[model samples]
Target chain A: MNDRNRIPIIITIMVILLIMVIGFTSQQRERLTPVEKWIGDFFMPFQRIVSQGYYGVEDQIRTLIRSSEIKQENEMLKEELHHYQSELIEAKLNREELMELKNLQQTLNSIDRSGFSEPITANVIANNSGNWFQMFTVDAGERKGVGVNSVVIGSGGLIGRVYETGNTWAKVISIIDNSSSVSFRVLRDGDLQGIVSGSVDNELSGYLFDPDAEIIVGDQLITSGIGLYPRGILIGGITDISTSADQLLQNIEVEPAVNFNRMNKVMIINPKIYEE
Target chain B: MRRLFLGSLFFFSMIIESTFLSYLPFPSLVPNTTMILVICFALYYEEKNGAIIGFTAGLIKDMIVGRVVGISALTFMLIGFLVGYYNRKVFVENATTPFVLTAASTILHESIAFVAVFLMGYPIHVTMALNRIYLYQTIYNALVAVPIYFIMNQILHSHFLKKSY
Candidate 1:
């Protein structure tokens, strides 16, 4: 084959491959086959090694750039911490009294115990590189008992859920992705439930189950334990509230508790599997 | 043999983009290394080799980070092939070819990806993607192209590329 004639042949091959790939991918969105899982597992170690080196250098650079701001922030945070510590001591005493009352009430009425389990810690290996969508890879999978739909929590609160997994690695879809939706209730008003879903922007949105439900700014939102997530995990705080012109539903915005920018590690909740 | 080397390079580039680049200051503004590599190869290497490299690179990318596979594969492969076709007309040896090509091809790649994702039922915010991703990536890629091109040029001239034509 002459050099001049090679371009057309290559283009033909590429077109065929493109069509085949697109067709194959469109059908396999949710999970990967065993072979695909094996491939991902094989490459996970290299990704981990690279991530460690990358993060080490990254932290150094960031520290140098933000030293002055950090100093000021450190002092402010110290004062805040002292104030919060005093409040926490008081809250602990109230919590103890509440637990005693709850135990007495439980003795009077038979209630099933909440089945929340311990979490498996995992190191994040990779984050979203191409699109505006929020997704990440964590270095835990079937080996560590991380499975599909496992809820992941970061420093402050809920981060996301494990979307797909191999033998040694898992992919997490952040709560901010357009497709992810979490059933939540206003922590202040336990009766009010809604579905918090991701949108095009950074913030998340949910509609009040009752259009008349009063949603105030700064209200805390927590998982309602209806579907995927366990009940009572802090999801975010309400940042905005509004009603459409027709007033069919009240639209609310939530700011997630986890700061994705600083998240390096997460915990995957492993629900106990009851044997059939 | 050369294809294997390029394939691994592409894979390594993927790892870097996902991990290293994400930590950079203003990480969102980091250049698209995969696009840069593809365009550089398309501009400098033979048309056929460029397309094959681009296809393999995109597939590796899709396997790792993509929510829906093959969207990036189609986008990058097409960009590689189109840029390669114009290689004959463009002066590959010119100092500024890579910078110019990188700038043009970034827009082309992002636009194609946007269209493909849109077709796949993704509700993309066109203006936001255009401003945040496409525009910033183009400028960043253009800036990074100078160093990447020179390094790649050196590597090619050292042994991998022989002046057979």
Candidate 2:
């Protein structure tokens, strides 16, 4: 009866369980586990507190060490003030001119969201720590109409798509994740299309469909409107481009428009744009 | 009580890496603190304890940040068991032991994880992942492990003090 050498049985069971969990999670797009949602929501407030403190400290440090930047900002503010003062005098002279100005501004803004609805804003509460996967949790979720596949954009350009959401928190898998890929074209030439993919280095690189596309460094890239992302979201500028080893496709490196490490706020594209 | 302490310690360490260090300006070099804890714990205790700690830490991570669960759990558990299995063979007091062990463990973990992910059909570029990402990660972990080892030794002086000498 001393044959109770049971360590192997336990290890085997664990291995089998792990494989099953992996299989289940990998195939799931959203609601992979209620456990994940509960844990994410439970710790969200704490993560928010930490992010706020970090933001406060960062603002202080930036103001302290950025005298040159502050001076530039001061100059810009002065210019803005002067411009506004002139606009005010002009407005006093002609009320109709002011209405025209308002219309022009609205028209320009409409182009940015012409096909989209008003975007919902969210705060990034937590980010993945190590350099493994590019992901984070935002404070807006299903309660705010944020659902899986909602496009997230920052001040720069396209951020990523929401892969999971809870009541008050949603998880975003950013475009810079190695597993994420986007179809894009050179904004300079719409015919020059390529696939921009993320890597473990947290960098963006892609390959062009045509080897002779005549693209160059510093050329802007935008979504080609072929995939989950809508057309015209600025991806980034090409930093380097060279032919692949086989020379069939042009390999290009990109610097994403948004700095993933320092992102604070993001906007989620509303799903109601098509219907309305 | 000891289990509670270790559990909370693992939780905090996990947060420090994923939340705090992640927000840092130069977070590229942030060490894997939870993995470090698992390695140290395995070294300080039995193989069974090591595997258990590793499994728990990895499971929590998967629940929090992992896209697919079990990848981290399997790799981290293996690391814990291997380290703990040979815990008594190496002198813990030697300043270089942690540096060496951490470096090796990180390499092993990254390689196994990379292969696992690739096999699972994620579109990762191999040369880029190995050259640009995991290399830096391994070096950074080894560097951080030195100071972390001394701190852990200080906290659990009684258990590991004799083993080091």
Candidate 3:
């Protein structure tokens, strides 16, 4: 570890570092080829293991929080017996809402009669660091009929689609993903078909190419039943519209009804099977 | 055997990071924890083996969630080498250097990722992206880095540096 030896080692390391940076930059500039895709698939298992461990930790925290809340409630009820009836009614309403959500899920499942008939339910595993697009991993995977391109829906509406799948886990690309694009139509006036695209920050928006297409800020957007996704699933609501003086199409912004960050339960829609 | 175990642990942690930890709702400007933790680890263990581990971890990460290929691997490798080289000379055995380095490295890692995306013909709004990167996420990553470093260091030490004690 003499100064002369250290200097040469540092210079060699710096040269190696320089070469690596150049190689990486060149690779990033290119499109993701089949080789890259294969590599991505190979690494998916590692992602799942990490996701599962964090989920386990979070699950314990959630259980502790719930149990503590329940204990507090039990103690409070001893002194405030009169309010018990109202609390009971509130609890019943909460139960009913939960049941309604379950029913909605079942209905969604029934409609999605793909070859892979089993339903996959996943918990919200994570969020992005500082970007608008929030992603999640579900416990369901190939073993449970989860696959890439499967649709995911939350309580609010169509959340996103499965982008990566492992044996026991899957990663969802939320609709807010900047690269995501879906063919959607206005529920009120089905005439307006436009491509909904995600912004850099997952602020959902799109461009309607048809100049005469009838659309407004309050209109609802639903999957157009074109391409990978099935028809009539709710996407989001139009939040704003901006028309440039010379532009042919109307620039639009949408606020996704589905709060992907808070979603605890999601149903993965198996890819549809077409009859010959 | 220890190297294998440590390698698997780091690999598993990256996966959890992309899948689940990425979904947590932080206040608008929090940086990603995984990027910071990985950077810190790369800096703390800058040996040839450490660089290899860092590169493997980055490669695994790139495959899982990143759009670009090789970027994370290259970045992690560089950070690992620098950190390792620095550690050998300056002796950052304490926690403060990790905290400061984690903060700086998180920013560097994100910038590189963002620049890579932008350079790939993607029409990115640079200002907005930078806002997310520097303001919220940098702060968040710095805060989370200490705990993650502590946990990861303990795991690495127990698994790989058993003879040191």
Candidate 4:
């Protein structure tokens, strides 16, 4: 009974320590603690393998389901088919990304912000386990100049910010996370600004600072020079204006420009480099 | 053998849950099969081993997947202790034991996590958190518990089950 009785006392101490850890981690700490970095780095290889293998398996499963008739016909041929099918899918995906990259480049060029250093490209290595929070780890990290709050841009626009960084990897929390909020300026009318936030459903909703601001559906949005984000990064276009219970703050829904589902590669930019 | 097997199972579950489960067809579910693993051991051996397993599993998950560390660890640890403490009174072997316990634990786990994250100042919609995340995950984890429980029982029979009896 002594051992059994001691469990609660031991657990009480542990629970308190764990709570303190939770509080410390919740803050916007730029670098990973030594223990955290070691663990993260240790798991990096396995996570990388699993992420890649997961995609490969997904492609294989999709191929099998799409051609169930052919799949049942031959086991040997199925293996061969899976190979060719994955290759074909990978090539198609590559082309789509190329087009997206080209479009992003064109948009950046048109915007004419050439003072910024070249964006560090990072391969998304692993997605955070659960769907409740929107976060993913990328291969680029402190070594590549990617640090906390560095803006992560995907194919279309802003994905999120680097929440934490290791020597060779960084965890990015997307704008669509329930906890994340971004300040935006309506692109159509530059002075009309608001705060946009993400919800659990991977959707964005925001309210204008000025309740009387002239805003409508289909208006574009960009990052305002407030908060951690710098000015002029494209956010998304307004989708619908909802009649909220609170008339003091006019709320609007937004369709984020980045197609988060299909986003794989991202560019990390240090805000200080360009904000100056 | 028990130590080695349990270690492998813990590491395997961590990798699979974080990597493969997220990409599976269902988008809204987390399928926390690891919680079932903790519950099974707790039911068999009770709190002493249970708390350690729960804490270790939760710690791995937090280090890898969690945005906020210690939430899962704390919740899982407490759940393991509570489950073991209550499980000590009922020594019967029933098929539904693991299943029902897993379902209950999932809800408790998610609720603790939900409250913790919310308290940490994350804006969470109540309906979305309840309907989409907590409910969906509870069903998935409960369903997964049966097979996992049987397998774990089978594996632990020689070394662990014989000792207590």
Separately for all candidates shown, the number of backbone clashes (residues 3 or more apart, or on different chains) is: 0, 2, 18, 0
DockQ of each model vs. true complex: 0.52, 0.50, 0.31, 0.56
Score every model by TM-score.
0.83, 0.82, 0.68, 0.81
Q: What TM-score does structure 1 among the candidates reach? A: 0.83
Measured with DockQ on alpha carbons, how good is candidate 2?
0.50
> In model 4, what lDDT does residue B63 have?
79
Q: Supply the TM-score for candidate 2.
A: 0.82
lDDT of 3 by residue, A63-95 (tens): 887997878888888769768878899999998
Instruction: Please say which candidate is ahead in DockQ: 1 or 4.
Output: 4
lDDT for model 2 comes to 0.80
Cα lDDT listed for each candidate: 0.78, 0.80, 0.67, 0.81
Chain B of candidate 1 achieves a TM-score of: 0.85
lDDT of 1 by residue, B1-165 (tens): 665666677778888887778766674455778878898787766566677778777777777877666767776777787778788676656657787888888887777677766766656777878787777778788889889888877766666446332
Spell out the clash pairs found in candidate 2.
A129-B18, B93-B164
Q: Candidate 3: misplaced stretches above 4 Å?
A: A1-120, A123-134, A145-147, A212-214, A272-276, B1-12, B15-20, B27-44, B64-69, B90-96, B147-165
Query: Which one wins on DockQ?
Result: 4
Interface root-mean-square deviation for each candidate? Answer: 2.4, 2.2, 5.2, 1.8
Report the lDDT tens digits of candidate 2 across residue range B64-118: 7667778779778877877877785655558777888888889887886777677
Q: Candidate 4 on A1-276: residue-level lDDT in tens?
A: 688889999999999999899888877775567877877877777777887777777778878787966666678787889899999999999989977877798788765344466799987777773756888888888888887888899888889998888887888999988889999999988889999998888899998888888888899999997998878889999999865687788899999999776556799888767764
